[model samples]
Target: MSEPTPLQTLFDTLPQSGSVEWIGIRPARGEAMKALNNVMISRGTGLEGDRFKGRETSKRQVTLIQKEHLYVIAACLHREAISPDVFRRNIVVSGLNLLALKGKTFRIGGVVLEYTGLCHPCSKMETTLGPGGYNATRGHGGITARVVEGGELALGDNVQACS
Candidate 1:
């Protein structure tokens, strides 16, 4: 309806492309995350067997974190390494900037997802990351998305702007 501002233009441009590095599924609330190379996504079900599958029907259907941010998050906690699992997000991607996808759709494998907003750290991080877990993940938590197209997504799958 109107011209987008420079910031909006940049946000709409997905300059970098990356692949799905890893996948995680939370089978139950407060349960340990399970790592997987592949996962099934349905319109209503977030992840086939994930605990949050049908509980949420909004942009929170799926979550993703940039793999590169893991190091930054770890540094904040003064840790040698931080497993992606600790974040509890559903997908780990590298190269592409998730923030840039807000309000836009991207395809991961055959599944399409629309970015909602930042997946800010929850109180769970306090215990998950240990002493400074919560604070370390403050800005590095990632983003949330609602499934747009249901399909299978797997490790090494290319994620790019919707064509």
Candidate 2:
């Protein structure tokens, strides 16, 4: 095999580490998210209790958002603050640029995950976050991921790129 190009090397090197700030699971579609300190991540099934029932190869087994983006979205909507649950993502991570994880596999505590695609804001944002909510979350919607290895993940668990 040939050596990796400069860009590949750059993408592979992620020195910054992040931590899980919050975890949420929805028992069913359109239901309110239930926050938790920790939960079991299962291969093929995603979060143990999440409404998601995708196959093992499904790209959107789990959804995540950056904690910092919440502030940006709030500011865009002229709000004092925004809660993570309103985004309907499964995880809220901080201290890392989640975009950097695109096409990469990372670990959350003992669980490993591979980035799949961007988690775009849905129409529900308009009603849940008020007017202009959809536009406010346009680029801040974060990414979707599929489980690579299953294990326990908890609030405050270290999140880092896989070597």
Highest lDDT: which candidate? 2
- Can you write out model 1's per-residue Cα lDDT over 9-126, one digit (the tens) per residue? 8777776789999899998888989999899998767888889845446768999999989999888878778889988999999998887777789999999988789999988888
Cα lDDT computed for each candidate against the true fold: 0.87, 0.95
lDDT: worst 10-residue window of model 1: 50-59
**What TM-score, computed on C-alpha atoms, does each candidate reach?**
0.92, 0.96
Off by over 4 Å in 2: none
lDDT per residue for candidate 2 within 12-97, as digits (tens), equals 88999999999999999778999999999998899989998889999999899999999999999989899999999999999999
Which structure among the candidates has the greatest TM-score? 2
Which 10 consecutive residues of model 2 have the lowest summed lDDT? Answer: 43-52
In model 1, the runs with Cα more than 4 Å from the true position are 1-4
Candidate 1 achieves a global lDDT of 0.87
